[model samples]
Target chain A: MKRFRVLDIVLGILGLLTLLWIWHLVTMLELIPRVFLPSPAATIAALEWGLVNGDLLPQTLATINRMIQGWLLASLVAIAVGSLIGVSAIARAYIQPTLEFLRPLPASAIIPVAISIFGLNSSMVLGVVVFGAVWPTLLGTIHGFAHVEPRLVEVSRLLQMSRWEFIYKIGLPNAVPDILAGMRLSLTVALILAVVGELLTAQEGLGTAVLHAARSYRAADLYAGILLLGLIGLVSNYGLAIADKRILAWKN
Target chain B: MAQNAAIELKDVSLSFGSNEILTGIDMSVEPGEFVCVIGASGSGKTTLLRMIAGLLPPTTGAVLLHGKAVRSPTRRVAVVFQDYGRALLPWRRAYANVSLPLEASGMPANQRPARIRQLLAKVGLANHEDKFPGQLSGGMQQRLQIARSLAQEPDTLLMDEPFGALDAMTRQTLQDEVLRLVAERKTTVFFVTHDIEEALYLGDRVVALDSNPGRVAYDIKVPLPRPRDQLTTREHPEFLRLRREMFEIMNKIHA
Candidate 1:
């Protein structure tokens, strides 16, 4: 199994190299106009320049800060509300339909509503991100807390545990695997919403950078921003995967 | 303590909508008594144990603990479930799993470590205190569950086929260990199992249940001697006779 994992990483790197080669070939062959699809080399040059003497690093940091703050807010609210709904049948009956209705509504569509509330600033961007990123974690928490093994429930009951004690000792710990999985998914949603919020609100982040670069026809710079966004997504997902592994080490 | 029964059920009946699970069940257990209930599958043996533990309320009659009607779970009774894998907290190490009851009862943080350690040691899990339930073998996991139950410091234990999932060899070892521990602590035990001989080996009295709305069919006392030897006790004339009787009754119920 360990051997497979090592081999798996090597295979992943190979697959990435293959994709890069294809992109390079496409640009060199002029399969698509260079102005529309920048060469790999041109994109890399733009990325280097942005990091060395441009506002790319700060832009990247701003986007990350906004994304993280929004994700954290969503997660705290999700877990609190999810736990409440998960533990009670009556609450679930009344609230689940409303959640189902809101779950699939587009976050981008909510931008105008949020702008009206928070006035087209960072808070509006934060609001949009929170709205989009809250669902997966919320649903995951509800499922996890609700589906705790019946035998454990019996044990808890026999111990005569208080409601607070039951949640702290059993409900929360039991839901860790599901909650983390939901958080991982929500992180992706958060990054997407953060970029969208930044673009529309004219916030100083990668989304605005990408949007401004497109208007000026700086294809390489636009591609560079896109590349950085992809990297951020990959890295954040990897970090969470490591955390899930550490937390669920006891799970086979 | 001497005057009141440790556990009592008077005409206890339970129904889920239209289907009856248990009906007209009446029994009593003295303090420190080891009573085992035996039945085939769907005999509501587990349901009966749940009622005694106050996890399920009977549709008719009452479950009494120490002369008090049990409407809710009492801290004085600890439950050990058959599926040790599910019974235990997978995230917690053995020490922390045993600390659950103590923590729930608000034991002082500074004082919990010693009690947790002692409980783990009592269940022969001292060396594996840091191991999670998933890391332990079947027997070890069940031992961890026992340690967790013991942490409650309960006067009575309600065990639902706890050894039903173990291999035969592990089952025998745990049976002996349980007998030793229960004897030492003088804890009243209500043990449920489908295994006839296991019921005979551990119980001071064996109560057999009939299925299709479970009711007590037989409640026979075991006249076997104390400090039972797993090998010799199985071969004992009275043990063999009682085991045969239980087997016959169980088979008849299936028929």
Candidate 2:
């Protein structure tokens, strides 16, 4: 098993090298103008320079900060309110239809309303990020809490669990798998919204840097920004996956 | 008889909207007695057990526990469900699963480990406390459920076909284990099973419930000798006679 994992990682790196080779070939041949797509070396150079001298590190931090704040806020609220919607039939009847209707409304579409409310401030961007990232965890929490086994509920009842005890012991633990999956998904959504929010507000983040690079026709810088965002997504997701494995180890 | 009864159902009838599921059911169990109720699939044996556990309320009658009307589940009664897979939380280790009732009852966190260890030891799962329900075999999972039930420290225990899903050999061993455990505790037990021989093997008395509108068809006393061995008692002429009688009654209900 250990050897196979090493082999898998080696093959994955090889695949990445192949993609880079193809990208370099495309740029060298000028299939799409160099003005539009920079060579891999140029992109790599920009990345190095951005980290050493430019705002790359701080902008990356800013975007991550926004994502984490929005995600944490969304998760806390989801667990709280989602339990209500999950456990209470009356709450479900009233809130579920409204949620279903709102679930489909895109987060970007909320930007106009958010701008009207907060007027291009950092809070406006945070609002958009929260709006976008909240759905997956919220719905997942509700589904998880609602689907607890009937027999377990009977066991809980026979034990005479208080309402809080029932939710904590049975409801929350049952919802962990679903909630974790939702949290992973919401992480990606949060990153996207953070970037989008930064771009619209000219916030001091990678999104703003990318926008500035695009308008100035700095193709290498733009590509570098995109590359850095991809790396962020990959690393954050990997971190969450490790947490998921550790928390759900007993599942095995 | 009803005065000192541990559990009593007084003319209990259950209706679902317009559909009557159980009608005119009356039974009383003395403290520390093992009463096994057996019937076919739709016989409302499970419904009766649920009423005793206070999981459901009979539409027309009262389910009383220790002379008090059972409005809802009380901590004094523990239920071991048939679907051990669903009954035990898959996320929880065996120790935590058994700790559920203790946690609900607000046992001090520091005191829980010893109690949990003792309960797991009771069901022969002491070393398997770290295993998850999914990690354990079906029989082990059922034992985990039993251990968890024991943690409730109930005055009465209700089991709905608790061993129906286990293989025959496993079932026999668990039956013997349960009898020994019940012998130690003064807990009144209400066991429901479709298995005829199981009823005779486990119960001091077996109540056969009729289906459609479930009611007691016949209640027979099992005077088979105590400390019943699975091999010897199963071969006992009296055990065989009761088993045959139970089968005949169940067949009549099915017909």
- Highest DockQ, which number? 2
Which stretches of model 2 miss by more than 4 angstroms? A1-11, B1-3
Give the worst 10-residue stretch by lDDT in candidate 2 chain B.
Answer: B1-10
TM-score of each prediction: 0.95, 0.95
Give the number of colliding residue pairs in candidate 1.
Answer: 0
Give model 1's docking category: medium
Off by over 4 Å in 1: B247-255
Q: Candidate 2's residue-wise lDDT over B33-126, tens digit each?
A: 9999988889899989888888889998888887899988888898888999988889889999998888888899999999999989988899
How well is each residue in A144-197 modelled by candidate 2, as lDDT tens digits?
Answer: 888888877777777877778878888998899999999999999999999999
Displacement of residue A24 (Cα, Å) in model 2 is 0.6
Give lDDT tens digits, candidate 1, residues B1-255: 368999999999999999999999999999999999999889999999989988889999999999999989987898898989888989899888888888877789999999998888888889999898888999999999888888788899999999999999999999999999889889999999998889899999999999998999999999999999998999999998887888887778778
